[model samples]
Target: MPDHASESSVRPETPEPTGTSKPSRATESKPEGEPTERPESSEAPGMSEAPEFRDAVPSPPQVPAYAQQGRQPQPPNPWQSNRQTTGTLARLRPARPAAIRNATLWAAVATALLSALLLGDGLGPNLLIVAVPAALAAYFAAQAAGRRLRTWSAVWAVGGLALLAVPALRDAGWPTFLAVVSAVALGSLTLHGSRSWLGVFLGSVGLLSSVAGGLRWGMGGVRDRMTGSRGRWGVVFRSTVVAIGLLIVFGALFASADAAFADVLGNLIPDVSLGDAPWRIFLFAVGLVGALTAAYTAAAPVRWDDITIRAGKPRGRLEWALPLIVLNLLFAVFIAIQLTVLLGGYDKVMAETHLSYSAYARQGFWQLLWATLLTLLVIALALRWAPRGQSRDRTLVRTVLGALCLLTLVVVASALRRMGLYVDAYGLTRLRISVAAIELWLGVVLILIMAAGMFGARILPRAVAASAAATVLAFGLVSPDGLIAEQNVQRYRSRHTIDIDYLRGLSADAVPALDSLPEPLRSCALKEIQQTLRTSDAPWYATSWGEVRARDILEKRSANALVANCRGQGSEGGSGRNGVEGDDSYDPY
Candidate 1:
């Protein structure tokens, strides 16, 4: 026997036992490049089974300890796995700061108190007193919420404040109502960081959301604070309770000790009666909800401009351009007719149509207004579906839409001219003046759209909004009732007739113009307004400039005696119809 173990260790690639010895199946199936294994022969050396020989065989790679123990790896804990993700979100978007919460809370309280003290009686200077402080408080609260007052935001804020002045300047119900609505819209835009028209609408939605969810959001913050540090919150609560108790005890004693002090206290504090509690609470709740809504919106403003609306699928050139071209031709035809009627052919057209000037104007004015509005819609839709793959497509869109805008402006002008004719024929009324102003404003908007086509539309939405606001402000400043009264008075001077009943229904804003009328007519026109002024007992803070002027005019002219003496003055030729009643025959709607 040779030293088989030594030989095997030295030459692991040696051939297996030959002849009678059979090789194992593993050795027989082994590839040619692999080393041969030892044969199980009795005469084979026992040292071949030693650790050194066995160690020469290769093994698989090591596995995890758990796998080695014949068990699968344990699943991760779901709660622990989400810790990092939640931590990241918390770090990225923290809650509103305590300072902002406190400031806004105080603002709500102040707004509530001011509302109870200065509002709810009537519309006047007191509106300004209440609105200005509330707006300023909201502005400062927004600043605390980390909103920088940029130029646009500042413009909106200032515009809102200016609109609030309408009540102080004029006493007409419609103008004051419009001012309040516009002011609220602008305030929403300012608080929610909206600059586009779509953003304006979305900001309105955000305002409603804030109103609906603001209380819950505030309570969430309170819950967090109370739960985060109980000891600190408990101490604060006890301190607040003790402070209130001490204040009540000391304040009652001081108030009773001196009559002057009691009077001063009475003046400083609101009179809170059990009977009036519900109304006062309702007013305070309204103010609180408004202030809190603003504060909540400012703290976490929605980026409304970031919302994108996908455009309609673009059409082929012929498909998109054909309808617009036909519409443009129609618009051209209408413009040609309008021009024909406007130029020296008005008499011929009116004669052929068998209609008076007023009838012609009234019949066509409303239709033209609708046409103008629909043309705008058509242009918008055309632009949305216009072909957009080539420069020629862009040129076509600009041409068609621009032509449509220009034609719509002509229609607006026609409407306004017809309104002028109607007003000339039958004097001015609130409806006529308001419609004319709207037509003029629409014309301005069309001009803006045309300019936008030349340049870019990035500023178009805000410009339109600003123009609307400016229109409203200018309308208020000019005093619509006063203008109507003045125009009617001038018409009366020329025609030697007046609608005394129509003028009598006017607000105090028309006092000066009505006061200029001839004796009996003036007395008839000012009768209702004079009685109103005498009966009103609004506080000084709630008195408007229009009211003050009306009172002064009435006192100087001794309008009471004139109105008393004017009995059956209408039959004395001071009041008569200048033309057919325009409102009954012509429905502008």
Candidate 2:
């Protein structure tokens, strides 16, 4: 054999010439892909590990037979150790840890300041109340979001806030303001790459997350050095609580001893008014705490992307087309019947149903409203699994689905007409007006969905959401209360079956509409309105533009009938929103 020999491809139990070899221990220690000795006949001198043509790649970490995979070390925490600000145990890790920490710190500060401002006099004259608080929340949220998500959210937040800030929006009444608030609520999903529904959900939860800031503060501040564990500053907390108790007791004692001493400690003592009052200072403290926590929750959002994304095999083309075809046919028949009814009008409805106009209108309106709501779900599912390929199946599914949306919109129109007829007979109420608004909103959403389907837009849900939000803005601008009142008052002028009791129950928003009434009807309406204004027990914060307008109406022209009608009637706590003569009007608050 040569003096310098290549590593062997074979191993023998015993040496050939010396009749001796090491035990099998050294052979067993070599790992996978290592140059191990194998007993073979046709292998080349240098190709000891495997054949020359076999591909090479790194394998899993080499582990000893005695070592367990479970015992491997974990990765380090992404966030650097911070002694101040924010939760150390992050609810969700941000893409950039440093940016998140800074953002959270700033957000907490902003939230505290907001809490201070709100708890003092509170925010408003409308949107200005929520502006800085909202911006702070948006800013903190933007820190963790990508540029695209932040940008989209910014557009919505700005638009929604600006819409709320309009003076007319306040005058429009609560429904209009609430409608707009719902639209803004959608902006809570301002985090980029999040689903719109998820945003809506988080936005809602964000409203109640006020205590999260305190939790975060506690988390970041509490840590053990020697034991390497987290610990709270409980001793200091208990001591502070005890000290406050002592101060309260001693201050009470000192106050009883001297008037000058009592006066001196006035600034030091807090009058929470733990007495017979319905509300006091501590109530505001609780509210501020909740607001702060909610701000923190918004700022440090836990992404629900993994849970929000539905996982399953989307229905195949055949599966999609089959149900959609059947559904479209049903809708077509319904539409056909609806079309016939539309041309027939009120006379046909009475002849066929043999019911009063209001009864006839009431029965189907509720069902159709439900149908409209249900159809939205059906349309959502069809879009979710709609085939995208340029094939007959995709075309068929799209066409059928679009037809379905159009038909549902027809259903919406029918529902609106029914409600309109009902309202024409009964006059306007809040519930009737709200239902009408919802139906119109549904129709608008269907239209958006149809447009999205035509263009094969992936953002179908978002587009629908945006459209719904826009409709709310539009509804607010038009003002639902004023519209209801105007339409009802006009109906009374034309039909002359005005519900005097119903008009009595109308809110301040309806005052302008009722103001146009003539003589006896005008006196009756003014009487109830005047009583409501004079005896209303709503708090200062609850004061509204409607109240102001109602007050103005009452001041400008006194109603002698109202004074006489309510002469003996007491303004009891049972009066609810209005206290004038038991609020006999049929108007629902």
Candidate 3:
């Protein structure tokens, strides 16, 4: 087979030289080490030469310039990729500190300072400004400490040790300051365990402090922060509108003849303090929570789509019982007050010297009852008779009813104003019958309206509509109190009276009588007597408010005596009054 194949290849070189070329064919047959090829004719029929063997696939082209270099073409493993990603993040992250010692230190220092200030035992309004700042600082510090502190034990020990150092700073009355400082430190430490709860606790504490101290400005800031992230401007705007309405309505309800706008503003903006204890602060907190919660709850349903199903009419067990609840609250308060007056052992001495627990309770009870009843009545009237459907007469009825309500409110306010003046002039402290009679009448009117309006277009609308209506209702019905105006004047008058009258009776025996009076009254009496002894030549005309009022009556007094002197330093062309005159400017200084 090999000889035949080699002969066929050699003969193919030349057709005519086949015999001579056949020698090469002999050489091809005996080719040293090389394998022999068979003749084409001897191969299988119609067979072709086998193709050259090479790699099954071609090599990939070189990577482009933009491609990452120095990496092999390895298939990706999801697990490995994830690990790399996570490792990169781990490297970039910051390490947690072992302990927030600096934060703890600062918190401790602040707490100590507040405690020392509190020790005076007469901190009162004097410490309000400082207490608010202390509370805020403690809140943030707690957040930091939460990151580092691992256990409640550590938190308490650190906070306690910090407070213990309070006594060492004697110059500031560390002992007293320690009490307040310790309270803050402990409270803040407790907040470290849970941030959300911390926010709640801190918010609550801040609220209460604000209320007790009458620190409306401070509280307003806190509320802003809590709700700022909500991105719900409508909620905020509506709440503001409602608040304005509430203030207006409340003002109208309790408007006093002696009320002045300046005094009202002052009351609205408190000096703030914690010395009043946690309870008073709690009330402040409650009022703030009430306002904020009302705002948020009222707005939440409108904005949150998922919660819309729960947003239908407020028809729960709570809604059904609301009318009864309101009535019970009013009656319970009234009954308690009556029982205190008729059966309780409160005497005239107790009333004159200091209000007993029962007296304050009764006062609060009645005030609460009055406010609640009026608010409920407003609600009932709005729900029942506030016009339904899109009929023109309904709108007309609403307008008429609204106007009539406003008129009725004004008339009631006017009557209350006259009565307050009458009581003040006559020195009649008792007011049980007046408040109850007023609330009772208001509640009756409300119940009747609620009964009539139950099945109508739920005329009160939903929360938004209700809020708008309530706001309008409040403005139409309520009036701001001039408690500040009358209180300041009354205090001044009381002091002036004691000064002029008490000193004239100040023989040696009169010292005991002076001591028997309260501290403020005692102080006024002593100061006048001492001054009289020091300046025996002074005339009675020099010490009279009648004289001061006479001078300032036409002059438009600039604040008080000091401000009057300061007026001389004003710009030469400007008048001394500068618009702060009148009763409005009396204590505005």
Candidate 4:
């Protein structure tokens, strides 16, 4: 067969792209290894008999340039267009009924899931609220992809399911971050057969793909089908319009006629402003389209790199290291101060700093936390793209970096110790617990990265990702509230000073732990739990298993005399607010 691509031949079906010059036939190159033309076949052109071959079907006669000019080129196929216009979607779209129904259904499902996640049980707002919907919309959007997307889609789906499985643990801050990262990783793997850093970034972009996907889904054959059915729809549309107008007219008349009937009718059919309908319709249309778009894009993501244009070469190691070196020295000085303070213990800090234990503990923790995170990013960028193979003094740079990372661990430990001391003193809040968990996770990742750096570049990223995920997962497995409650209760038992107000503010996750407190404290805690449970907006269908379990604890308590005892005392300010001067109330912060 002739190498058509290599030859300067143009076929009737394959026109050159617009604006590109056509290859001249005279300048065409002959295929390699072909016998020389035998001195023009020992005959003049057109005068001698033509040579014929049996096996030449693959190599069609090349249309001459003159003949091509006489015969107009066929138009481009919409399906094969490189530019992704709506026609591309029209070509690849599924059946109209299937697309419309499935898109609508999945869109509703996505909205419902959002509602459930938002209004149902939760551990404050985090990544799942955003990511799960994207995953879901992607799941159903890829429904058209069928078996092609089965594995990756399933993995993405499972990751989302895992995220929603434990509501109480959702606030395990590091675990939540890891779970989101895992979901993004899984999404990229499914969408693009990638697990690299680029893949994760693309997965994030894919979340917004739904908007375009929805457009694609709508622009798909559905629009054509709708246009095709417009003749029939026109009559139906006019008739419906007339009917609506008449209904409004008669409804107003009837309402004016019978007040009671109008009241019943009004109850059954709430009034809607025609003025706002367009905006509502617009929003609704956008949501449906966006949902389907997200799904479609997630299922069949466009090549992200094709659109992305990175700017320039990374800064050299020396450029990065010089600044990093300065920071490392500063950190070294800080570490020296920290070690001295550690040796001196709380007493030395008190006398030297003239600050109380809590003040000393809380003093630099937040600043150190930010410093640790910033340093991690700095180290990551420094190690990741800093011309390692080309640099002559890279080993020395790495050793210096390794020492810096090791010193940073002491900073992490200091932060952890400081936070722990503060928590022990002030009792725990959701925010405090989240910070603690994140710091611990950061510490683990630092260790992983430091160790991985020693081995080689190949090991570092994978180890960091894996270790970070594992650390988060481990943290998520333990109910933070339960732990917080246990610690606080222990502190209270030992010191006899519990923060009743703070404990009262905790969510249902703390109920079981708080329940273990002695009578009056337990009663007061149960009242708070019962009130939170009673006032919950989560529908039964949307309730997480953890929430259900929490509710059951409340229900069982209500069934016994426990609820009555609390309720009876609740009116007497069981909240421990109004204490008589001589009264021995169990009120303590």
TM-score per candidate, in order?
0.75, 0.63, 0.25, 0.59
* Highest lDDT model number: 1
Runs off by more than 4 Å, candidate 1 = 1-100, 219-276, 561-589
- Model 4 lDDT on a 0 to 1 scale: 0.59
* Backbone collision tally, model 1: 0
The model with the greatest TM-score is 1
Query: Given candidate 3, what's the lDDT at residue 217?
Result: 27
On the 0 to 100 scale, the lDDT of residue 442 in model 3 is 53
Instruction: State the local distance difference test value for candidate 2.
Output: 0.58
State the displacement of the C-alpha of residue 26, model 3, in Å, after optimal TM-score superposition: 73
Off by over 4 Å in 2: 1-127, 137-149, 162-184, 191-193, 196-214, 218-299, 308-319, 345-349, 384-390, 535-543, 561-589
- Model 1 lDDT on a 0 to 1 scale: 0.76
List runs of model 3 lying over 4 Å from the truth: 1-101, 132-372, 380-401, 428-589
Kindly indicate the candidate among 3 and 4 with the higher lDDT.
4
